[model samples]
Target: MTRGTTNPNRLRRVDRWMAWALGDLLRRSESAPVVVDLGYGASPVTVLELAGRLRAVREDVRLVGVEIDPERVARGEAVADPPRVEFALGGFEVPVPDGARPSVVRAFNVLRQYAEEDTPGAWARVVGRLAAGGVLVDGTCDEIGRLATWVDVWAAGSGTSRAGVGPGRGGVGPANAPVPHSLTLSWRLAGLETPSVIAERLPKVLIHRNVPGEGVHALMNALDRAWAVQAPLASYGARQRFVATARSLRDEGWPVLHGPARWRLGEISVAWEAVAPR
Candidate 1:
């Protein structure tokens, strides 16, 4: 288990991405969509914040805060409102009441503690419990949530797997692979220095892979170059500089996603294949 260290609003960058960038996913969910905060650490404040932010999109969204630590579960319980939000004892299993799967699982700062080889397994466990059109967002971030990144993973298919965990009735198909869609980077603009700072918090699968000859390394190097080339834009503020750099990434065929609207918020996302380890 982690140190259970957590602070209020230590996840704003990601939250904004989920609420706004991923709103389409939520909109597609049933009247009462469900979201899972897989490992919210010692506090439940972030969970509460998630409910508040998401309510703006899916008003009837349900939220669950899963924790392996019984004590942490108790902490979440103290603040939970049944039928809408609840706390439970679970690890990567991602157990939810009534055998229902989650539409979105945000397991930030959860897999870094395990061996790199274990990342795919952890992902499988979570993705196995996804609802239709669900997305498993596994990621890592700094203590105060300034710099953050995540991979949007979609489930692989139909059939039963993971100890009684089978796909929903008429689910996609039988499978056991995670199809990652994109890699997103976010930063708190105030103290921003260089975009490469996020290399320190890359997911387990890509963290060590960010070395010479790796696709991720090349991506970072490309980003740094674009950032440098856009130096004169700094006079307009870091936002403009970041937007120009992101534009360069897209122009160079780096497959960058999103646009200036998001870049202005100190965020940019790229297709996963563009940087997946070779």
Candidate 2:
């Protein structure tokens, strides 16, 4: 019942990241898990795009795009390739064939309508559907996919907490409650401005926390400062400026997770603690 406002390649940023970040997991799944694209909107292009990108990483990758609306599901099924890219009707249930759990449940923009406090329960539901070593990516993005952010959630001992980020250190919720392993920010660097623009599109949990006196707010401010100070590198292109800004944030005690390799792609990941709400 979520708004299905989607378009072709709208999720290209995250999909590209997945191809590199979780490609290995998909390759090693051994037929145990499927990749689910939850709530693919009115269009199935993104779903088709997901299959294309993921298949390049794992030729035999099993992929499914799920939506609570049966109409959308039917639409997706029309153009899907059988046995590989498929569509299903599901909500947070994250249904898969033969009761198979998913290795990665990518629920983007599906929870934007829910209350912030509802995130934990909804997240737990999605994570519960994950197979061993599974990951749930709860995220949001702009319509055209220019700016985006997502939180990576994993089961205990899955060792899926990656991109150089780990729990605690301010990333994990107090009392050791389940929290995001890493927070990722991505953008189309050409015609880019300051990095703080991503604050508007952060995952639901941190979206409202971008105001003054909030941890996420402070983090965005710091990034803006760093991005400004690194203006000299703009001559080399936004990529270099972004890489320098990332290094600056790290040097300032921010637990930035990804390195220049990712930063150069207009992406930066951070341990959740570095900006988790106080």
In order, the Cα lDDT scores of the candidates are: 0.82, 0.81
Stretch of 10 with least lDDT, candidate 1: 159-168
**TM-score of every model versus the real structure:** 0.91, 0.92
The candidate that wins on TM-score is: 2
Off by over 4 Å in 2: 161-178
Candidate 2 structure quality by residue, lDDT tens digits, 156-196: 55644333333424433433234568789998899888788
Clashing pairs in 1: 157-173, 158-173, 158-174
Q: TM-score of the candidate numbered 2?
A: 0.92
Residue 146 C-alpha lDDT in model 1: 88
State how far residue 19 of model 2 sits from its true place (Å): 1.3
Give the Å shift of residue 43 in candidate 1.
1.0
